[model samples]
Target: MSNPLPFLKNETPVNWFWVDVSTQNLRVMKAAHETVRYPISTALNGLGERRNSACTPRGWHQVRAKIGAGLPANAILRGRRWTGDCYDASRDPDENGHQDWILGRILWLSGMESGFNRGGYCDTFRRYIYIHG
Candidate 1:
């Protein structure tokens, strides 16, 4: 069977975190290690309290859950299921009218502390959404 922990095998036992917003690129950081960054596209018309769908949330979050762990890279995902096809954003025409596709992997985010990003409107956990490749 394919190893689900593919990303973890290469590095030491360090914690990993990531940040992505509509305006900026995706940033992944591993504790005591170099950070990996990539450009991303967010919601176009701005969604939620963030006001702008393009604006990424600002706060502290943890990977509450990781999905599609062992799936092949670029595998199409919908409703969190693998469609058995690799996806290339640049090559595939946008069928959903959105340029973003959370594929291959998903990081479920949860707020760390209360008030700031925990409860109320700023809750990241309750607003759980998939983040893809």
Candidate 2:
């Protein structure tokens, strides 16, 4: 958190994003300090970097890539590809409609620290930890 002010600059020298699991908040920040915050839910399992932990890794991360930029809101996606369908609010989720989807905008994250959130079995990218949906 040292020098956290740099993350607020309207003209950022670096591109980065932050996920605060404690508060369930995602901060889309970095060079366009056009920062935006959104509510998020982390790992269905818990917190950790180990693969299959189903946990959200800790430490610094970057938006390695973006997906579904133009997809409609609540558009259902399967395995990162649009399922050619959108969520029907009238239908219940138990009806097998867009229960857990990585739809809308997806920002794949890669770890910035070695042996922690990155590298070996703790690699976030390998772990498929992302700021998605």
Candidate 3:
């Protein structure tokens, strides 16, 4: 694994979030030291960089924007905007739960590396990849 620092000096310590897909875990790191960990769910189709692949993209990324700043938890969002609704069991009355819902706060991510997860079809920003509660 390589350390990814964007615009920050190497000697300067900072906090970052590491999403370990294989372990289904997310960890908070301060200067390469783990501070906290949490469980996370990834895509059903696994990992990829193609559009509509229904997979998680790999590589370094930075948060491009934060959405739903003042919204309550489980706030339903569509097209990156709050739909003025919140999630409930009634939302999935059929219990199939096949719908992909973007809820709560969102951290829109943009890939940093070119020709991989950044430019063209691999662009994470255009793909609408996000980290949310």
Candidate 4:
């Protein structure tokens, strides 16, 4: 596998959250700690940092904030603000609906690297990308 991002220069990330687009998994790694991997579902639109693409952004990112704390499961959120309403998937599941169904908890991400995942149309923060549950 050739270098995906040449800017990385073969350097290893100390503590990072990596989302594998192909496997639909997110790997969490911390220094001196066991690596953990979680099954995740990315956008069906595919990968890109461009705004409004509905695609998952690439490159370095940091968890800017944690939302939906102390909130009940299936709580719906709009514009990162809780709508105070919950959508029960069991009752009225998406099942191929137009809505993205951003429910439960959300971990807002901000890009650390400029000109890639950050800045202009490539900005993930501006794109409203989140690790949502």
Candidate 5:
């Protein structure tokens, strides 16, 4: 059996992926393909592992878990809880003053094979940050 996800192909050429925390962008590169880019959110002050703080970690990571497969974009999520509503960027952030919900797509990340990202200093999954559409 094979993995069903588009990004989870086995034997696919090894591609490099990186996220720039400062610019809130994700980039993926394959040998001959153009680098695909996506907008992302990081830690507000770039600190802490608590909920409600939009601080994205700075380091190397892989797409640990890709969720909401075949789901519509802009889906609403609260407390990791999915509400029936789908949201766009135009939506007001004030509605949920705390805790940015993971919607649309979820790439649950585990730290990479090296550096501060591997251990207690900065664990991606433990921080509870999720990327959405």
Candidate 6:
């Protein structure tokens, strides 16, 4: 609820991504000022650090990897690999029936805090938690 910038005083003030699970919002902060904001959807199971919980982990995180660079919009990615299929809503609404495809780009996140979301079963990267659109 307060400015998170103070917590990052020791860190560089280049750019930071903040996700508020309560409001389902993601904000891009530059020098303590929000440059962009977007609506985000978190796991239905809510927040947790355990694996297979289908929950969003809380704690500091950094972008570990950037996926689907230069790829077309709506590109279907399965297992983090491009399937060469683009989603066309007009064709069939349930074309990808029973399957969830990671569309667009993926910002793979790695938790920075140890024993919270970084190591063991609480590992966010191992849990495959990503910010994708």
Q: Name the candidate that leads on TM-score.
A: 6
Q: Give the candidate number with the greatest lDDT.
A: 3
Write candidate 1's Cα lDDT for 71-119 as tens digits.
9878877777888878764656578865556678887777655665567
lDDT of 5 at 87: 74
- Count residue pairs with overlapping backbones in model 3: 0
RMSD of each: 9.6, 5.1, 3.3, 4.5, 7.6, 4.3
Give per-model TM-scores: 0.62, 0.74, 0.82, 0.76, 0.62, 0.85
For the record, the alpha-carbon RMSD of candidate 6 to the native fold, in angstroms, is 4.3
Superposed by TM-score, candidate 1 places the C-alpha of residue 128 at a distance from the truth, in angstroms, of 2.5
Poorest stretch of ten by lDDT in candidate 3: 4-13
Q: Taking the tens digit of each residue's C-alpha lDDT, what string does model 5 give over 1-133?
A: 6553334345445687666666778777787464798887665577543334455665556767777777677777665556878876566666556536566777677665344554565676776556665
Cα-lDDT of candidate 1: 0.63
> Can you give the lDDT of residue 84 in candidate 1?
81
Better of 1 and 6 by TM-score: 6
- In lDDT terms, how accurate is model 4? 0.83
Q: How many angstroms is residue 21 displaced in model 6 relative to the true structure, after the best TM-score fit?
A: 1.3
Clashing pairs in 2: 12-31
lDDT of each: 0.63, 0.74, 0.85, 0.83, 0.63, 0.84
Model 5: per-residue Cα lDDT at residue 91: 68
RMSD of 1: 9.6
Clashing pairs in 1: 46-52, 46-53, 47-53, 102-132
Considering TM-score, where higher is better, how would the candidates rank from best to worst?
6, 3, 4, 2, 5, 1
Q: Give candidate 2 misplaced runs (Cα > 4 Å).
A: 1-15, 29-35, 95-98
Q: Provide backbone clash counts, one per model.
A: 4, 1, 0, 0, 7, 0
C-alpha-based local distance difference test score of model 2: 0.74
| lDDT value, residue 79 of candidate 1 | 70
- Reference-based TM-score, model 5: 0.62
Per-residue error (Å), model 3, residue 132: 1.6
